[model samples]
Target chain A: MKIGVIAYRGGNVRSICSALESLGVELLYTAEWEQLRGCAGLIFPGVGAALPAVQDLQRTCLWEKLPTWDRPFLGVCLGMQLLGKESEEGPAPGLGVFSYAVRPFREAPRVIHMGWNAVSPLMQDPLWYGIESPFYVYFVHGYRADVMDCTIAEAVYGERFSAAVRRENFWGVQFHPEKSGEVGFKVLQNFLSICKSYQP
Target chain B: MLAKRIIPCLDVHEGRVVKGIHFQGLREMGDPLSLGLRYEELGADELVYLDISASVEGRKTFLTAVERIASRLRIPFTVGGGVREVADIRALLEAGADKVSLNTAAILRPLLIEEGAALFGRQCIVLAIDVQKEAPALYRVYSHGGRIATDWEVVLWCKEGINRGAGEILLTAIGQDGTRSGFDVQLIRSITSWAKVPVIASGGAGALHHFLEVFREGGADAALAAGLFHEGVLTPYEVKLYLHQYQIPVRL
Candidate 1:
């Protein structure tokens, strides 16, 4: 199956692409919404701040097109933050795919939470698949998504926050599965399988 | 709580992984890709590839080796040695490396740390400090593969590096490197207390107990070793299991 990774100015396109390809999934890196028609799934990988990332998405017209994507869609890190209504990191409006707001960590021992941490699944879902509960995944961010009904997994650094969120066809993970080792790849593998089985 | 990390460091010279005693008398370990994959499969938390000769030869890191290893493994990998500018960091990240470490260049132009962190985020910039004990409890920073010593003290330099936007510090004690004794617990304890960021204690790791001491006594968030891991002296799996038994959180 083919997956389209939305390419932006500051996103980690190469690493995301390499990770997906290693799982035997064909990738199409594009910003044009029309180009995504041939793919069965979509991935939005990101790095950098929210304001500039939203500005780049708007510039490429992907911001307006993201919410309507019918296939299995995954957003990673800043990509996941962009799915919220807004972020404390910047003044830009997020895609609002989920009814949650992204905010910076408060009273955190450290501002930047960088490294491997565990996540506990809140419910059984195909996205988790073979991954064990409280599996270690790589995270590097300052802002976190507030817990909501759509939250699938939660992790605690200074406080409990959303680690992975799912809303129908759209999925978002605050961690970088591309760099989270074998456990991380299991999550990606699950997503790819979901795409392959997706009727649309 | 975040589990303590066990990282296997690969010192590469001319595209071959090498090991040395106290950074002298280098011996070839094996190919970077195979050794890296082996460590990853053995449950290593992360991997570090240091081009030991890059700075000495005045060239960039071996990108080909990085790309090959990065493509094969599905883990967080850091590449260091001869990283001198923002462009170099960008190039390494573009080649699929999760983080790029700065050493000699960061010391020469301190602002490069800020520039790199600003361009690629602080999480992508790692400040690697090679420190030598100048006197009792006094440590000095070394550069260019431990060939040149600087006036900057280890603790103060690490604090400055954190202030300049380094998200993590890779502290290697030159006196203990490859000696297989143990980590410089005093130096690590002092640096960890002052630095708010995570400290990765490198050098002088012989047994699994050494790893435990660095974490428990030295207050290190992570421990790294080259020779012991490369020579099969201790497997990452065995170390993690040992740490888990001691109630020191580690990913099994």
Candidate 2:
């Protein structure tokens, strides 16, 4: 099955595309929704600032078109932040696919949690199919999403925050699975499998 | 808890890994891609590639090498060397580098740090400082690959870089570099105390205990080594296992 990775500017498109390609999966990396029609899944991979990222999505018209899509979707790093309603990192509003709000890490010892951290799964999900709880995943962000109802996995820096969240077919993780090494590759592989089994 | 990072630095000159002593003497190691993949297999948390190529043709070759490494290597990697302008930073990032470190460029014109941060976010801009202890408690910043000493003090430059929007600091101690005795714990602690950004302690890593001291005593967010790892003295996995025994919280 082909996966559609949105090609917004300032995103970590090369890294994610390379990772997915290594799995021997077909991909359509584009900004146009027309090219994404036949894909089994869609991925929004981001790096860099939030305001510019959201603005790029809006420029590509994917900002409005993305939330309406029913296919299995995965968001990585800042892409996961964009899945929420709003973020404190910038003035731009998120896609609002989930009701969560992203805020800066006020209580953490350091602002940017840039390293590998253990992920504690809170609920059973296909994303964690083979991955065990307390699994180490790579992260590089200063802001975090709060532990909400849709949080499937939680991790603590200073306070517990949403590590992974799933609502219906939407799956988002604050960590960069593309850069998390072998275990992270497993998470992406699991995501592709989830997309394959998805009916809609 | 956030696990401390173990980064293996690869000095690439004309697409081949080279061993540089205090950023001077160069000796060939192996191919960049293979060595990088090996490190990833050996459980390296991240990788840093410093392109030491001087000629324009060499920089092109380094960029190609970076693309090859980025495609194969799964973990994040930072690329630095001769990054003077915003276009330079863009070229490295577009070539698939996760972060671009600025040393001489940022030191010469601090506006590049602010400009890079504005264009490509603060997270990708790393301020790399090479320091040499001048006095008992005073350290001076070095430029031109630790060859030229500058008047910029360590603590002031670090705070200025952070204020100018550098997200991370890659602090290398010139005196301890290539010596392999141990990291300059005093230098690392001095910057980490005032700087809020993640400080990567580099140079003077001899034994496994040195790594522990940098993390526990120096309060470093990450520790980097080149000659130690390139010489087959210690692997990243072995170091992490050693750190785990000390409750340092490594990703083993």
Candidate 3:
């Protein structure tokens, strides 16, 4: 199946593409919605601030089309933050695909949480098909999404925050699966399987 | 809680991993991509590739190496060395470097940190400080590969760099480097006490206990070692296991 990675003009999209190529999957990296529409699944990979990413998405009209897109989707790092209703990093609104609001990490020993951390899965899903609780993954961000109803996995630095969240076909993860080693690669492979089995 | 990071730094010169004694007498190790892939397999939390060459041709070779490493490696990696202007930072990041480490350039032009943070976000910039102890609990920053000493004090420069938008600090002790005795815990404690970002303690990692000492006593968020990992003396996975036994949180 063909997968399209949304080009929001920022983040390590190259690494994501590289990871997918290693998995031997056919993929398309494009900024145009026309090209993405033909793919079976979509992956929104991003890094950097929320303001510019939101601005770029709005400029390309992907910001409006993504929330309504009826296909298996995944968002990574800042892309996960963009799925929230709004962000503390900026004075703008997110896609509101999920129920949480992105807020800056406060009361933490360090402002930016950068390094490896354990993720605890709260419920069963295809994303955690072979994963166990308290698995380690690489994380780097100053802002975090609070644990809410849609949160599937949670991790703690200074406080418990959403590690992975899902609602219907939308999946958002705060960690970089492409950069998380073996377990991370397993997560990607599971996502691909989800896309292959997706009826839409 | 966030697990303490075990970063294996690869000092690259003209696109090849090199070994040195106190930043002199360079000798080749092996290909950077192969070493990096192995480290990732061995459970390295992250990797840092410092391009130590000074020539323009060396810089080009480093970028090509970065591309090759970025394409295959599944884990995050950083690139440094001779990153001067905003354009250079852009080139490294565009080449797929997760973060760009700035040492002398950030000190010479503090505004580079602000500009890089503003353009790419603060987390993309890392302020690397080479330090030398002046006296008990007294340290001074060094520049030009520790050949020249600067007036900026260790703790003060760390705070200044953070204020200028450096998300993390890679503190390396010049005196302890290549000695393989132990880390300068006192120096690291001084910086980690007040500095807001994560502190990566580099230099003087000899045995398994040093990693535990830095994390438990020194309060370092991460520990970095070059020769110990490069020469097959220690591996990141073994160190993490040792740290875990000592009740130190590390990715296993």
Compose the digit string of candidate 2's lDDT tens values, residues A145-167.
99999999999998999999998
Error of 2 at A137 (Å): 1.0
Provide DockQ values for all models, in the order shown: 0.69, 0.82, 0.85
- Cα lDDT tens digits, model 3, A9-84, are 6666888899998898899988899999998899999787788888888898788899998989999998899999
Q: Supply the global lDDT for candidate 2.
A: 0.91
| Model 2, position A18: C-alpha lDDT score | 90
Q: Residue B200: error of model 1 in Å?
A: 0.3
State the RMSD for candidate 2.
1.3
State the fraction of real interface contacts model 3 keeps.
0.89
Model 2, residue B108: displacement in angstroms? 0.9
Looking at model 1, residue A173 earns an lDDT score of 96
> What is the per-residue lDDT of model 3 for residues B1-252, given as tens digits with 9 covering 90 to 100?
788999999989888999886557889988999999999888788999999887889899999999999899988888888889999999998898899999999889999999999999888899999999988877999998888899999988998899999989999999999899999999999888887899999989999988888888899999999888888898899999989998898888
Displacement of the residue B43 alpha carbon in candidate 1, Å: 1.3
Candidate 1 TM-score, true structure as reference: 0.96
**Native contacts, share recovered per candidate:** 0.62, 0.80, 0.89
